[model samples]
Target chain A: MTDFWLAAALCLLLTMALGLVRVMRGPSGGDRILGVQLLGTAGIAVLLLLGAAFDMPALADVALIFALLAAVSVAALTRRRLTREDS
Target chain B: MEMTLQLWSMLCVGAGLFFFAVGTLGLLRLPDLFSRLHALTKADNLGLGLVILGLLPWAGDGFQVLKLTLIWLLVLLGGATGAHLIAKRALRADGEEMLE
Candidate 1:
């Protein structure tokens, strides 16, 4: 079971690396940020799987923090863009 | 019963992994920002939710279950709002660029 969880986490990490390709090739800011969003999400899933695999519930808390920060980062950037445009 | 639960967890987690893969593929191949955003948010949240569902049985107690549920809910809310805001920003920037 632990092996299975770890393998799943590896798969997610692969996908995240592929997502980074999008970030690299992005022709627009929106696309780039979207790729970053994908990274954050996959990261959370990987963290959760690792938590489960290692029998450590603490990683869930880390995932929760990742979720919150992921949300805030994008929103903050968007807000800053808006404010900069206004001024 | 233990075997059954383990099998169930594997199944759910496997499905979640598939969704995450599909979401990433969409993000890479989708034509434009709006469509890519569409793929990102829906697939990302659904995949994450499925992952959490799979982990539920492994949760040590009621408290762990609650914590997992809360995390999923937070991700869902945050993803939706972030997607919306990103879309709005993209639209505004597009309009501004055209004006220029």
Candidate 2:
């Protein structure tokens, strides 16, 4: 089980790297936003994995909070994009 | 017993990671915003779901599993909704029809 989670974590890290590349090289604003969104999702997964591996229940709450924040941020950004277009 | 649990956990984690990798690749390789969104949503949902599954065996009990499950649900809901909103706003802003 420990080995399994470790491997999974490693894979998730690799995924993060890929998303990071997109963030760095994204041609447009929307691409960057998508990259960041991907990162947020990956981060939440990592946190949950840590919580379970370390027996830290509080980490679950942290993941929850992060998810909420990510959601709100995306919404705000989307709204901004819409308004910018209108103007 | 513990050993078996650990192995299963590893498999779950590995699957999760694989999904993440695929998502990342899609994000980088896809041409358009809508296509990228497809990759992001699919990868994020499956990747996180796998991670949660891997951790389930080690969780203390039913309550802990329940908590984890709830978190998973929240991720799915939040991720999908957020992506949808972003895509919609982007489309409307550009005067482009939303992609299915």
Candidate 3:
């Protein structure tokens, strides 16, 4: 079980590294937003893995909060951009 | 005895990781914002969902697993909606030009 989780975590870390490359090289604001979204999702997965590994329930709550916040922030940024363009 | 369970767990995790990798690759190689959003949204959601599924067996109780599932669903919802909104606004702002 531990071995499985560890391997999964390592794979997720590699995935995050790939996404980081996108974040760094993204050509547009929207591309960057996409990268951010990927990061947020990956972060949630990491938190869940940590929770299971460490036997901590609070980490799940933290993951939930992070998801909510990331979503809200992205939406807000989009809306702000739209409004700014109209003005 | 428990080896089968371990194997199953590893498989799920491996699947999740594979999806994550696909998403990252798409993000890197997709030529346009909308296409990139497609890659990001699909891969991230599936990746996280698989991870949660893989970890479900390790959770202690029904409530714990339930909470974890809820988090996964929230992420799915948030991710889809967020991507939609951003893509819409971005397309509108840029007026259909491929971003340079």
Compose the digit string of candidate 2's lDDT tens values, residues B1-100: 8778777877777777778888888998888888999988988789889878878877788988898898888878888898888677777665543221
Candidate 3: misplaced stretches above 4 Å?
A81-87, B94-100
| Candidates arranged by DockQ, highest first | 3, 1, 2
Candidate with better lDDT, 2 vs 3? 3
Compose the digit string of candidate 2's lDDT tens values, residues A1-87: 445455556667777887889888776667777877887889888787777657687888898888888788777666642347677
Question: What residue runs in model 1 are displaced by over 4 Å at the alpha carbon?
Answer: A80-87, B94-100
CA error at residue A19 for candidate 3, angstroms: 1.1
**Steric clash pairs (candidate 1):** none
Query: Residues B2-27, candidate 1, lDDT per residue (tens digit)?
Result: 99989999999999999999999999
**Reference-based lDDT, residue B46, model 3:** 89
- Model 1 TM-score (2 dp): 0.93
Per-prediction CA RMSD (Å): 2.5, 3.8, 2.8
- Interface Cα RMSD for candidate 3? 2.9
Best-fitting candidate, scored by DockQ: 3
TM-score of each: 0.93, 0.85, 0.89
Docking level for model 2: medium
Shift of residue A13 alpha carbon in model 2, Å? 2.3
Residue B40, model 3: Cα distance from true site in angstroms: 1.5
